[model samples]
Target: MAEEQLVTFGLGTEEFGVDIMLVQEIIRIPPITRVPKAPDYVEGVINLRGNVIPVVSLRTRFGMERVEESDLSRIIVLQVQNKVFGIRVDAVTEVLRLDTESIEPPPPVALGMDSHFIRGVGKIGERLLILLNLDNIMGGEINHESA
Candidate 1:
């Protein structure tokens, strides 16, 4: 059976994962420079090895309550459609490979989150992983025009 690798992370009490291939790197939360007119979810930009990469708060983007940064907080650098950006997440859990057949379509009720953002639900033993569609999550919001 075919298997796919995933980079899993936590947001509040929930766990989320994205395609490992799209992840550029993972770093500890870094200092951010706020952009005057950026959207609420946009936490501004950070200089990564001289490149100004925009950063977004996943909590705010998902309409969740913002919490103070903790030791576990991390910034997941991702490349979507050739655009590089970082997303602040509570904590990165682990990298795991799941069988493709174990993934099912998103359920009919997605707890009010836009179903389009969810790529699939992966079953790993007794654990259920919410696989996010990175394209849909960052594509519409992080295009150059919006930056």
Candidate 2:
């Protein structure tokens, strides 16, 4: 089987990536219809064409500093198993292919932060990106009260 490239986006200065197969589309941040009693990590649901899809802020989920929404903000729709969710990224970057040998084990700090969510780390040029296990990252409950 051919190895697939990973698609990544920026959250602040940090870059986060996921398997290309999981991403359905990337769009500009839109007005999200807030869902009552939903988790804080979930920005809320948006009408993607006619379907209602939940949007999540990866920054909030990973305990990163907040960012103001701008043109750069983008929604990366992903299919985590059967459920499809939209991830709010600071910005979407280019797609890059890395041979399997280029991926390394995630560091202890990244692993400790819900270790299961991090699949591995990939070095592209001089920059390093953490590849996320979307299934694990989106599996937990999100606290809406904090949102």
Candidate 3:
């Protein structure tokens, strides 16, 4: 049997996963040039090898209280909507595989927020894997009124 591809990461205690193929690379949070009218969740933009890439703070995007970026914080650069953006995470765990049979839908209440961001949940050993939907992760929740 072949193992499934799962890129694991975390925020405080909650763990998340994304398809490894979509992930470009992981780097420590770097200086971001703030955009004047960008959405609040859009942290700003960073220059990667001279190519400007927009960045998003998962903390801000998730409706959670923003925490200080510590030593372990990382920017998981992903290619979404034909654009490259870095999604901040506490720390990246490891890439593993879980069969489709192991994935499940999120429960009714994920703290009152929409559960659409979660792609699927995979029970791995003792921890539940919160697979993230990169497509809808930073796309749908954007507030134009506040921008």
Candidate 4:
């Protein structure tokens, strides 16, 4: 059976995962430079060793209530379609491997804010992971918004 590796993290009480291949690195929350006229979800840009990368708040993107950043907060740097950006998450839990068979299609009721960004739901023992579609999450709309 084929297994897929994921970089799992927390957003509030829920767990989310993305393809490990798409993740460049994970870093603690950094100072972000707010952009003028950027979307609310666009937290701003960050300088990572001279590379200025845009950062988005997943909480805002999902229309969730905002909370104060804590020590567990993280910025997950991801590269999708040649574009690199960071997503602010509550915390990063772990990198896990799940069998492809354990993933199931998302139910219609699961559709919520930016539901299209969800690839599927993975069932691993007692845990449920919301698999993300990185491409869709970092779609062109975000590029246009940040530009």
Candidate 5:
């Protein structure tokens, strides 16, 4: 069976995983500059080195109530479709490998937010992880908004 490496993180009580290949780097939350007229899920832009990247709040994206950032809060920088962005997560749990056979398609019902954001559901022992479709998370609209 083929195995996929995943970077797991927490959002509220639920856990989510994203393909490690998509992850550029993980860093502590930095000062975010809010964008005018931008989507509510977008926390804002941040300066990493010299490049500016928009940061999306996974909580807001999932329709979950916002919480104050804790020490565990982090931003996972990802590159999807050649556009770089960051996703603010409650806390990063751990990096793990999941067997492809243990994955299932997203459920018919929405998982909190939109169903399209989910790639699949992965099972690891007693845990259920919501795999994310990074492409759909921002889609093409975000690029236009940020530009």
Candidate 6:
């Protein structure tokens, strides 16, 4: 029975997970410099120890209502395809391991989020975690809505 370690975080009322290996570090929200002409989901860039990493708002990416950042807010730094970026999340819940058998393909609707962003659904007891598909997150063929 192979198990996958995941880092779970909160967005709105739902929970999401990403492979722990992809996570570089988690930090509290830092002062972000807004970038003009960036995508709506792209909140801005942050200076992390001299590294200018772009930050994405998970709420905006999921088309959810934006809320004020609280003490629980965190920025999860992830490395995908040799690129490093940060995702601003409401709160980080916990890290856990789940058996691969517990994961299922994304449903048709995928809880209202674009199915493109979901890799699969993992079930743990009564909790359902939406595993993120990092491949489609950045530098992929993206469709921007007309404002």
Clashes of each: 0, 2, 1, 0, 0, 0
Model 4 clashing residue pairs (backbone): none
Deviation in angstroms for 30 in model 2?
1.3
Off by over 4 Å in 4: 139-147
TM-scores for all candidates: the values are: 0.92, 0.89, 0.88, 0.93, 0.94, 0.93
Residue range 25-113, candidate 3, lDDT tens digits: 99998999999989898999999999898889888888888998889899999986566889999899999988878887877776445
In candidate 5, the residue pairs with backbone N, CA or C atoms under 3 Å apart (3 or more residues apart, or in different chains) clash, namely none
Q: Give each model's whole-structure lDDT.
A: 0.89, 0.82, 0.84, 0.89, 0.91, 0.91
Tell me which of candidates 3 and 4 scores higher on TM-score.
4
Global lDDT for candidate 1?
0.89
Q: What's the lDDT for candidate 6?
A: 0.91
- Per-model root-mean-square deviation over C-alphas: 3.1, 5.3, 4.5, 3.4, 3.3, 4.6
lDDT of 1 by residue, 6-122 (tens): 999999988899899999999998889999988888899999999999998988877899999999999999998788999999999999999999999999887457787788999
**Candidate 5's TM-score:** 0.94
Model 2 lDDT tens row, 1-147: 345498988987778788999899999887889989887787789999899999888888887878789888899998876678899998899898877777888887874366677888888889988889887656564223443
Q: Could you give candidate 5's per-residue lDDT for residues 1-147 as a string of tens digits?
A: 899999999999999999999999999999999999898888899999999999999888888999999999999999987889999999999999999999999999857579889989999999999999887787555343434
Residue runs of model 5 more than 4 Å from their true location after superposition: 142-147
* Candidate 3 lDDT score at position 141: 43
lDDT of 4 by residue, 1-147 (tens): 999999999999899999999999999988899999988889999999999999989999888999999999999999876789999999999999999999998877675756687889999999899998876665565343434
Q: Stretches of candidate 3 above 4 Å error? A: 1-3, 140-147
